[model samples]
Target: MLNFSNNKLNNEGRLRTVLDIGCGVASFGAYLLSSDIIAMSLAPNDVHQNQIQFALERGIPAYVGVLGTKRLPYPSRSFELAHCSRCRIDWLQRDGILLLELDRLLRPGGYFAYSSPEAYAQDEEDLRIWKQMSDLVGRMCWRIAAKRNQTVIWQKPLTNDCYMEREPGVQPPLCRSDDDPDAVWGVSMQACITLYSDYDQGVKGSGLTSWPARLTSPPPRLADFGYSNEMFQKDTELWRRRVESYWDLLSPKIESDTLRNLMDMKANLGSFGAALRRKDVWVMNVVPEDGPNTLKVIYDRGLIGTVHNWCESFSTYPRTYDLLHAWTVFSDIEKKGCSGEDLLLEIDRILRPRGFVIIRDKQAVIDFVKRYLVALHWETVATADSSIESDHDGDDIVLIIQKKLWLTSGSLKDTE
Candidate 1:
């Protein structure tokens, strides 16, 4: 209802990524898939009987999380839309911190579609809430894009003009100049607005292309990382060739329906996920927290990912991914003084039985992981040298392993 035509919403790809808070069963996300939109359905792991599990089983992208104290794992400007349909979140609590978090995630000129009683109800309490919400969003420089029936959509400002024009000493102040909006790994949520960068100040929106083109086009934010268009193109081509080789290696060992949910443990520029566009599987690209903040570049390319540190466990539930791709992840974490065995255990916890793992790293890391294969109930599928000819050092190895299906004593009796 934001006056968006079908062409604009579905074809133009202006609204590619979405954040669906309190998504129950993720039916809204499932519907958006036909329009080439991917929504990250988020819900809390509460007494609601594992709603996120049902969403995952339906092949919809979902995560078990809440808008709590910590920032969502994603980087700033990661989503083009944020939706809440009777999500029951108190947006006015704690100086509107939750709504501010949404502001951080949304791209400039992004929309928030809120559907709740406060928008339409005439009761006194509902009116009070509606007034408070309207004032809060107004202070945040969000304007009502559209309102109909019980739903109202608010659009964030396209630039920092409104923020700069705000009266001095506003309630929700702009974030400090030193604040890194992209630093989200285990970072606390701030009740402040993140001003646009100097580049964004001059631009209207995120300066990103549409979906298919965005998948291959060099993102404007690449300049923030000092990356040239040539480097981005080369990275894309490299992943394309590497993915082809990966499929060739996996073709014999797996059926067509084997790999559905995939993850890149250390996604760099999201080229790995972009290369797999033709495949039926969906990749959860993960950019390491310690590395360059490339998650924004990943989002600008229209791929989904999060900022994460391999030292700790991922935020999802156990047995979430069908295939895990670790390229230099073990070595990188090792250099950071994290335990490789602990990481291996965490991987085993997240990978489903019979799932696959592709680890491309130094021979030493492969040897270190191989030592725990038997104990982890995993078997080596295959090992090969680096397919890329540029690996003259010859230390790079591709090790593929599969988690074996096993039943514990506590579950064996139930099966019988």
Candidate 2:
């Protein structure tokens, strides 16, 4: 067994709290206590409560529950590290029921270690499990941090559904899957239910613990539930044209005097930037660092795009642009664990006074931006709804917003 004391994989040596499932007699918890680490162990002692008392006597906190049925009695994102040793239940299963609960329990960038002696077995049954496990990790949105002989470790993503591929040629990651060949949307009903159920239980974006209290409806199903490479390829041209036509329609209405510099958030293939080139606007685009390989084609077209991981804070100065164009950017960001409020705040910081924002996105995102705009006192100049919707996606709504320059005492004195 790898030493947990100084393992670099334990969140860069800052491992604090651990959840040890199927903790037989809580021996691991006792050891963790010796190392001054908080060990929250889970075990069953209904027939005989001796093991529970033993763990408590050792100064280790332990809980009683059937792992698969009962929800873990803890807040969301409560553990930094989770471990399971032959926990009876198949941890590598892609069913998404219990695993979704585990995902919710783990903090962003937290670690999960599952140890199985079967992984080292040469038997046919063990071999099949190992292969399925491999396939499961490949389909999951999480990343595999490391693997020992019988133990595999995973890290929870900072943002769910956001791809972070090291190589450019690989396909973008999928959020959820059912392994079903004939299901509509190619995803099983169970998988969709699990994903949304977890989301409702507070498996949400970075810095968020629960869903908005104002939301009365149940959480929606995973928006990109059954995404595939073929689907993306087919829709690429249609999406590109949608963006181009959106800007073409808005070009005449925009105030030419104020539209100088432009920033395109989530600039997939840089189509929106290319669309703005007809005007004299200096366009800069932002894309995820591990975005699709098609981005190379955009670069080949001589468009300006900067690679950025939107999961983290953006690197830019305030009030840097006069115009911002976003097509489905807010929805994508929201799906990947970024709140629209947070993104709009960043947009507000980087936009100049009286600058314009052109957003072509879904109704939810538009509502979020409008709420914040009203709170921030920004002005909305126009709104439009597209008659044509995405082939399989939601309808698009457009909003034109202008940044307001308010007169403060300091700035008023400067003008005087």
Candidate 3:
């Protein structure tokens, strides 16, 4: 089952609320929340009823309702998040309306995420249904995994923003519209029929939401490092754009391009942090870097203050991150629109002496990184920022530096 925790949901002090449609008996998402008020919807079945009752008995706010029913019993923009976990979407005739209704209930900009419905074998019906369901959601997408199962995420555009529907007159179409109510539901009905057909043909399986999981909130910005607000914002965009551009360049080089890029930076850092088994490593992280190409590894500050807040909830299975790495801190490397010796010095602190650092930064940052590293007494192992440059008067710099071994506690500069 999928869960949305404060980490993914946290945004500048905003209180969080979630609605899980096709919310089965176990209430997977509700249990992970720090607060209550999770809305639950389920199909009309004794099994579902017993599940909702169990959740309520355990003090989880739950309800029994059919998906897409007009009587959602909730007001406009009632929640900040609406999630679906292994909803019987493939087998429910009315799930189309349910998806639309979930959109209506979501505040503009609220997340509408669902993780379910693995692609069955290469059966004709399976592929057809897969295309139909995916096309129904806006082209916006994210993955929880790569194989048979996939998680899709989208957002209800804010009140002032418009959706990417077919252009009324001359513009190119960005995506196929699911505005046609009949067309949308028609595909869903067929999927339902297909699943039932399978069952009738002697296939049997329980739902996938039975497993339990927790959504987590990552660490807070600890003591402010030397970075400034202006620099932070600029670096954030720079890293994102650079990483995206790198993905574009690197795609053809790999077989599974998307998977490779995802593993390159942010996703890699996230998975790495989640896999922590050591106490010392648990406290380290690759945090966000505002500038381009800098990785955001590690919490905002030292791991000292964060362990307590994290332990409050995940005491038995606490979060552990030893070192920050990859695209997470790439922003810190690029220097983006920023250029400063002090800021450069801050970046130098993130590394453990003698540790290796891979940075894809702005062309301007190369000289700075070199100067900074030499100043910090680091030994350069290898450095290159796509040595080939375009004829255009612009380029980015890359540097690969490693903390070198020292025979004594004295600085490398002293030896030199």
Candidate 4:
């Protein structure tokens, strides 16, 4: 069985909740409830009355309901975890309508554990189901925390993909409408039929609720670090358009026909990396250590980029990347309690000679960049106003710099 503690459901030092689907005998639910975890269990009314009674006797919430046919009686984003084992529910049926329901119930960064020790087989049928489950979750952007012989644990993404579904009437559709209920559950009747068919064919499984996984109130802002959670949270289309326009203008000025390697510093969920990816280039996303589970979210999306932490220097050797893009990294570093000098030196050390560094932030940040970086042997190439002004902050400035190279003793050296 999967361990909830290992998954760190209470990592933030708070109480957590879970749902136990197809909870046979209600033993698991009872145990979780006894352990101070709020556990809810769902089993069919006709078949599991005694088990439900046992769960209720133990103070575990128990209910009778058929998935697919009956909507789960819980508000969306209600659970920190959902678990199923040896039940007769087809999670992969109807292109994963059941899984989508779980997704709906799970808060962001929540977990789902499906256990079937006896179901493990090299048979084509079993393999087919496993592959389908993996692919479906992959598309849903759920992170596979573990894939043992009899179980698979997945963590829900921290944030929904921004451009997964583009604005309606905007050229080609980037993704199907995420908000459309039909897209998640499909035709309810057919889904029900499919669930029954799987159960009859011995390919079916099992159903639960929880507390909210977020803090009850906002934490204090980093007043000194030039960063605010509010700004990062307000990434509207207007902000995207401005960033896109900046990149479009910068692309032509870059000399490389096929920019080989790029790094995005403090790349929260990799929207910038996704935006900048091309046919030939490899983009790497580096996020802060406490970026609210950013690395896993990016990995789960299977975007065209590698994920790393900003606390460490780039693993690549000196002169490795063709370009480095850090839209708001300096400010993020300030907020994250890291030295800007360390980040800049690492960027310079990893970037190839004359490789570009691009950043965008407020004018105060731009001035700080000019002052600090010039002292560290960096050459300022260009600085321009992004013309995007915020009501509470100054107008954004786009600063571009290049690493300088001097040949000495048959090797490249950094020089003024």
Best by lDDT: 1
Against the true structure, what is each candidate's TM-score?
0.94, 0.40, 0.34, 0.40
**lDDT per residue as tens, model 1, 1-416:** 76576645654777899999989999999999888898888886566428887787777788878578999888899899999999988999999999999999999999999999999967999999999999999999999999998899999999999999999999799999999988887789999999988777787778888887899999988998999999999999888887787888888888878888889999999999998887777788888888898988998988888778899998777887899999999989889999998999999988989999999999999999899999999999888887444433257898899999998998999998
The prediction achieving the highest TM-score against the true structure is: 1
Q: What local lDDT does model 3 show for residue 91?
A: 28
lDDT to native, each model = 0.88, 0.58, 0.37, 0.56
RMSD to native for every prediction? 2.0, 19.7, 21.0, 21.4
List ranges where model 4 is wrong by over 4 Å. 1-240, 256-258, 277-279, 304-309, 372-377, 388-394, 409-416
- Which runs in model 2 stand beyond 4 Å of their true positions? 1-253, 388-393, 413-416
Which model, 3 or 4, shows the larger TM-score?
Answer: 4
Model 4 lDDT on a 0 to 1 scale: 0.56
Question: TM-score: which is higher, 1 or 3?
Answer: 1
Candidate 2: tens digits of C-alpha lDDT, residues 1-416: 43454553332334545788878778886776544344667774345335654554443555555554534444344466788888776655446445656765565666778889766656898888877666554554567787778888877665544443333433222334543211211122232211222442354432221211101111122122343535434544565566565556667656555466577777755556554544555455666554442333233233334445555555444665777888787777777886777778887886878777888888877887887886676888778777643543447788888889887799999999
Which stretch of 10 consecutive residues in model 1 shows the poorest summed lDDT? 386-395
Per-residue accuracy of model 4 over 247-300 as CA lDDT, tens digit each: 565665565453555677766655565454333444556555444434423332
Better of 1 and 2 by lDDT: 1
